[model samples]
Target: MKFNATLLAQFFHFILLLIFLRIVAYKPVANMLKSRQEFITNNVAAAEEDRKQAEALRQQYLADMQKAREEAQAIIQQATKAGEVQAQEIIEAAKTEANRVKDNALQEIAREKEKAVAELRDQVASLSVLVAGKIINQTITPEIQHGLVQDFIKEAGDLPC
Candidate 1:
């Protein structure tokens, strides 16, 4: 092949154009691409960290809800137990009061019965004294004695004497 000056000059021009383009466009574009890649990597890492934090918060919230439920259940159980105890105490107090009232009523009935018996005895004694006075004032006959005894029985059986 012959040494062509025109071919050599074209090759030199092509080399100079490549050098200029590399300095002006290629390096800047490569650096921009590298910076963009770094930015994307940093953003992806930050997004992953945020996702992890959100997951942790969700777990904590679930745990807190469970704990709250447990506490509420415990409080309800405690209240139920207290109510049962109070109900039992009320029943016991009512029973005690009823028993006391029953005893008091029985005692009152006994006292009334005793008072009635004493009043009956007093009436009997007064009627016996009155009969004795009539017998002393009258002639003693079988029919008169029987009639007086019957009259005494009638007065004793009737009330408001």
Candidate 2:
């Protein structure tokens, strides 16, 4: 085949067009693609950091809840112990009051018994005096009167206190 000058001229033109496209359009498109890739990577890293921070916060909240529960338990125990102590104290106070009342009642009963006995003795003495007066009113000798008085005195002395 005979070489054509027209063919050679078209080939050179095609090569020049390719070099021009590489210098102008290809470089700018590549730079834009690189910038886009960097932006995507940076966003992914930031999201990962935020997720880690959220996890830490969740763990902290759980720990705080546990501490609060423990504190509530301790408070309940203390209140129970205090209630028991107060109950015991109330029981002791009641027992002491009951004993004191019992002692007072016994003492009052003894005093009442003594007072009744004294009253009975006075009554008996008065009756004896009345009987002696009646006897003396009737005619009797002085020696007989003295003897009767002595016997009455001895009997009165023998009465229970």
**lDDT of every predicted structure (CA atoms):** 0.95, 0.88
Best by lDDT: 1
- Report lDDT (Cα) of residue 79, candidate 1: 100
TM-score of 1: 0.79
- What's model 2's TM-score? 0.61
> How many clashes show up in model 1?
0
Q: State the lDDT of candidate 1 residue by residue for 77-149, as single tens digits.
A: 9999999999999999999999999999999999999998889889889998999999999998999999998
- Write candidate 2's Cα lDDT for 1-161 as tens digits: 99999999999999999899899988998999999999999999989999999989999999999999999999999999999999999999999999999999999999998997987679688868876786878777798778778877776677666
Judge candidate 1 at residue 80 and give its lDDT: 100
TM-score of each: 0.79, 0.61
Q: CA shift at 130, candidate 1, in angstroms? A: 2.6
Please identify model 1 stretches exceeding 4 Å from their true place. Answer: 1-16, 136-140
For each candidate in turn, give its C-alpha RMSD to the true structure in angstroms: 3.7, 7.6
